[model samples]
Target: MDETQPLLPDPDLACDEAQDEAAGKDFVDFDPAGDAENPMDWPEAYKWGIVGLLALMAFTVTFTCISVVPVATRIVDDLDGGHASRSASVLLVTIWELGEAAGPLLIAPLSEMFGRYPVMNAANLLFIAAVVLAALSRSAAAFIGARALTGLAVASNVLNPAIVGDMFPSEQRGTAMSWIQLAPLIGGAVGPAISGAIAETLGWRNVLWMSATLAITCEAVFLTCFRETYKVAILRRRAARLRRETGDPALRTVFDVEGVSRSQKLWEAITRPFSVLAGSGVLQSLSVFGAVSFAYFYIMATTLPDILETLYGLSAAAAGSALISFSIGSLVSVAICNRALDGIYVRMRDANKGVGQPEYRLPLLVFGGFALPLVASLYGWTARAHLPVPLLIFTVGVMGATMLLSFLPLTAYVVDAFGLYAASAMTVVIVTRCLAGTFIPLASERLVDRFGYGVGLSLIGCFSLLFAPIPALVLRYGPKWRQRSRYTREAEAS
Candidate 1:
């Protein structure tokens, strides 16, 4: 055996009987390069169908995360008898993010070990139940706990990108991921945009009921249409069928050839994200950049309603309506900028002698990184100045567009760099960003109270400015760093 040979068999190749006999083991894989059962070889329409379902699921789950933002005070007052602390009220929203922080660490790995379909559907069921629980809760603790549970079930956010990676190769992944990425932005924005009106008309409980209803609808469609996309899980099933049909128990997949027990595989999958994060400085830097960028978005989500209501004397419904600008910006970016992500990468790759490197994805990040700080500062100063409603709306819109600019490329870079370990790599990024999303909003009020919107948000913008050079640095040194990384090296070699 060549010492440098990859651990996993080439997914696109047939089982080589001679090689297997030489190695004293039979390993199953996609027998033909264009095997229809292989997700990569599935019909383009079907692959896109899966992406569409994933986008819907992503929107549904993320919708629940922020739908209550517009009605947080109403929820706290109704459930807590109007006596809850400000921190407690904020926790009603932030605790859900805490659940998001914890969920992907467990869920993404489980998806890798089991399969995408069962895990996602199961999480969807849990999310529906959790949202319904939130609607029925009569106390602050119960409502907060329900939100936390809902967050834990937000597997779609973590799994969507991994599923895209499973179905689409590197060349087309950015385009597929752009659609997936658009969902959460739209979901998060639309949630607050409509929830305030719903809460005002029907009560906060109805807001949760609306989220639960959407989740149930998405789950029904998903269960009906979504197919398993995890390559190892699909191949394992194929191997199992072959074993039963041929009565050859020795037949195995490259994943199973090691004779690892389900328990061992599960344990490794669960911990792999952390191990990868611990060992990879590139991943760590990306996680930090993503975390702060994520925090900026949540801070805006949680704070914007109050900013509009207080500074501009808008009604709750009007304040919520103002957030529609975010959706508008996100929509515009997805339509215009996201499609260019893959185009830019291909251009860079072609320029690099027809070899693609993960650094190619970093070009968009350069624009996003520098633009984010400026947008953040603009949002701050515009709000502090009590600028015209249209100006504030435009600023908020730009903020939404800028966030997607940063996040979409960053996600593509991680997916490209990590390859087979993309799920775990994404889990690392998800965990860090969720933690930031969870905790940073808790301080948003204090930041505004102590420093006012201009200085407080400008401070955040300044913090973001420090990270603007990250993409440039990564673009210059990424290949060398990836060469040093066991995970990236294995992914590349494989």
Candidate 2:
């Protein structure tokens, strides 16, 4: 084979393991004979194409996460197992987030043990089936069950960063990560916009059907475009092939370098997140801050329709249309992040004697931390006062922009902080985030009812104010902590 030829010529990878000891023989399992078999050695076009597909997958799963919000009332009426309150009906959203919090705990480890493809494809299929069940549901339990399953499946998207790290070197990771960051927000934003319109015109069930269609479309794209990005899965295939070709059961891969067994690997994959999360003050603080911020973000997002509908008396479709501003704001904010995030990191690195640290991502968050809460308060109070349509939308837009300003950097910071274990660290981020999404907003409805939109939103914004110092703390003290820890020190040393 030509040294330059792509190791993964197809999406399906044939990988391997090893038990070789001859000084002249290849002893490394799935060893890159040169740079040829390394994921980083793939052509840029292939790397980026894979990134695009992964982003689409993330978007599809996230879109389903909140798509039901616009039609919560309709679902309540259509499937009355008993007298479920409006709030109780909308708890389905929380149910989904609940599932998301646990899904990564189970699926991500399996993805490590097996491969990303089998896990991801199976999850996507379950998501599709869940959507159908939601659409055809005859009782609240069935629909809520489906929503929880959907949440569980969607958590797979949280692992996409591992693939980015697998393919892109540190220099190119920021831009690609920024793009992946947009998927969840964009998916969350667009879902209600389309679902509200569909529910108003076609029926509530069509909202789920539309989401199902999107799942199908994204899965097709995934099947065609994404190769097995997991190193173990790829090398395991290679090891298997080598064993078959040479009839040597003695062959093994480098994963055997430490004599780690399948059970031990599985145990490590499962327990590491919790242990690391508990051990690292950095991960703990980041998880809490990220969770609260995201909870409030979703609180604002899911409740916007309710606010607009109650305060301004807009129709379902109009309220949905109003949400376009949020989506627009989120999309524009991501574009800015994609363009500026890497530039900022590169510039700061250049100015600091060619040094790079995760904290370099913090300066943007400093601005975001203070600005987002203030603007979010404005959005809340403006909605409370029933302010002019233009002003409300603009305030919400600014909130969207500031939200991503902090949100995008935090994920990148964790990726940089954890390096090879970015996926494990990300599980904590995802779990904290989903916990917030699942629970915090459950109170928003009552909060708004009691204090009105302005006061309620201001309350949430106050929490943002409280957590604002997190990035700065990490910026100032993060290096020392990294030096103390094994994982991040490895990142820094490398």
Candidate 3:
């Protein structure tokens, strides 16, 4: 029970003794907690190399997601004869998010069954092909379709959290999670910041070509460097090897002893996110709040360029440069949260008699919930009043930091709550947020046109305030709700 050591159980000891006894003597697992094969026991430098690669992959996928925002108008003008409706133009940007929402359903389960290495590399290859199609597209429909395919193929965004869970202990995960989660936020911000200039100088197709290049590079590194990390998948491979070496068909891992077919496990894995969402009130609340955060973030990302153009007469490139404030704010949030998250969690666990609960991750979330409204209101009203551009930029930075404050803790909570099924649990959050990202920004332009920036944004702030109590409620009631959830209970038992 060394304080610095990971809390993972020895794979052999975790199996039911009676089940192993009844099944006969030949079985295979990592017998010692410090087994080199255990992902958590890998050399620190090696583990961090994997994390850096995953972070890069996460950055690439999300960078593609938002990179087109600054160039949406140019795209429509070139591809649609400048006659497409506002909704239709917006669809080109948002459709990618819809594809993101759909990908995790199959990818999460497949990764669980096979392993992270194969599933991720296969998806990365598809991602590169889709990006190439997008670059070659000449029509709006073709381009939207390509973007959607790319989103569907980008599995790293959803899978990275689970990979982090596989490799790091709970108390040590905060800094790594910050890197993974911050990549998307920074990517989403940096994408639009540079893309406007790229589109203006090179054209919209070149933006996609740039994305394709990044995708290709990421795939090359990932395939060559990443290895299998999922413990079940690793153990199953070991068991199969042992059976061959010893000539004993009786040799098994726990998965083999369970007597479940691959198809059945895949089917259940596909549906488990929905089941977990439907059954767990904690998940339901988190999804709602997470969706709100995503919607607000995307609404700003999709609308800011136009808003700045209209309100301040800024050029597209200048407006896009303004978004670099968001990247700056995200870096600041990472500095603050990375230093505070694990320290706070450890202190709270000690206070709770040296036991950790998922709710311990909620303190930062509660702070974020209240801060979101203030920043949203400020962002809206400043633009409405034609305030100084620097002031408006400052508000955007605050908004960016506040969003991550809510996002990082929410992610950490789900990973902690649903240990074995972290990927599936994370799917619930990603799918919900991506759905919100797809649809919410579609209405933002209209809302601004009708209500003005102040009223429209204040309305969003009000909606956020309504759900701001969610983390607090979960903190109070989560344990009882977890006890009632078959999914959470099963996760805990495993």
Candidate 4:
């Protein structure tokens, strides 16, 4: 460990066969942004615990956002809106997601420059303040601003899965991801019901207050439970701490390259995600699929309560209760996938003689692609036709299948394909998904109005069916495609 000796190469970059190449590379002069003591190498139990904690944090933020819209009518009444009241009311929900959509494009890349903890901690604080501000707002402008701030804070929720990917081995990714996907599903389903009840019993303002309280609580939990998992960040911090204790400024750490300055490294850290996205086919494909699914979820979320309350003569509380079916569907899918995904992985491995590849994750995606559009078609048609409540519930059942099938594949594929830069790849996923979530709500009512719910839903279903061929296409050409990717090579070399 001589100061002048070149540091060892990133262990993650050096797989079983690449160890020799790693040894011959003069250790690449350690850079924290690229160094690799990734969380994926951690013990299984510890990793799963981290996954559970992050999932809870995600659930809390997402739950609060979706629920707030159900009580928008009450808030609008309290705000004394004239003709513009309706537009103002809708902005409260839309602004939050719009802000969230902007975050990864802005803040996430910075996390790689600094560290995950700093970004997460700052975002959590922003979320709490935004919620508090919204609670105190007496005007529409104030309310809209508060919601935007909250969305900025909630944007970090996108990074949690990337952290989990960093923490667990790729083979065991499905189970950990189950919790991640499950949290959002549960949140989206339960948000309206719980918010509706609270709004009725307490007040619309109290809903934001309650949300602030939850945000504060989650911030505390994250501060206590979360650690810096981005290995390079951990090393950088460790190096600083060591320098402080020893009072030796000359003490070198793994990432302290002689020529490259920290600022240069920071620039690269911030830019790498975009660089990869521009260069890698795998990343581009997964992000597209992930974003589409996210858009569909948000569109459905914004529309469902409105449809239930207006068309079905259901009370706000009852309309919220109807979402329970969606939650049930999500849970059922997770349960089934958790049991089946590992077996699926093993079978793929056996078939390929242990040369496991990313294509293995696609089968689940295929199942989801088929289920999602069909469920949308069912829900749209059944609800529009004024069919029996049982039929609507059956649509929920179909949706559950879609959620189950899609969640594992996109997640697993991204983790396996992205290597150490999984966070950046996921950031792209987050940006696109949140954008879809934000934009879909704005146009969903219009789509339904113009085409009717059944037709609109069926159209979405057809579009989703087009995505079904993605997995097969990727399965056939994925590795060959990866071989041509410059970012993939950097990832493999990392």
Per-candidate TM-scores read 0.93, 0.90, 0.93, 0.86
> Which residue pairs clash within candidate 3?
none
Worst-scoring 10-residue span by lDDT in model 2 = 1-10
Superpose all Cα atoms of candidate 2 onto the true structure and report the RMSD in Å to 1 decimal.
5.0
- Quote the positional error of residue 412 for candidate 4 in Å: 1.8
Candidate 3 per-residue lDDT over residues 2-27, each given as its tens digit: 11111122223444642664566565
Off by over 4 Å in 1: 1-25, 257-259, 490-494
- TM-score, structure 3 vs. true: 0.93
Candidate 3 wrong stretches, greater than 4 Å: 1-24, 257-259, 490-494
lDDT of 4 by residue, 1-494 (tens): 21111112232332432453245532222443533444644566777778887887788787778787676756766776543454455566777767887676656666665667888888888888888888899877787787887788774455766676556655667777777778877887788788889888887777777777877888898899877776556656766776788877765434445676667766665666677789887777767776666566655655666777778777777777777777788788887778777668778877877777766767777768667777778888987898887678768766866865775677666666666556666667777777766765566556677898888877777776776666667767887888877545433211
Question: lDDT per residue, candidate 1, 421-460, as tens digits?
Answer: 6778888898898898888767766887799889988887
- Please identify which of the two predictions, 3 or 4, would achieve the higher TM-score against the true structure: 3
**lDDT of every model, 2 decimals:** 0.79, 0.74, 0.80, 0.68
lDDT of 3 at 217: 90
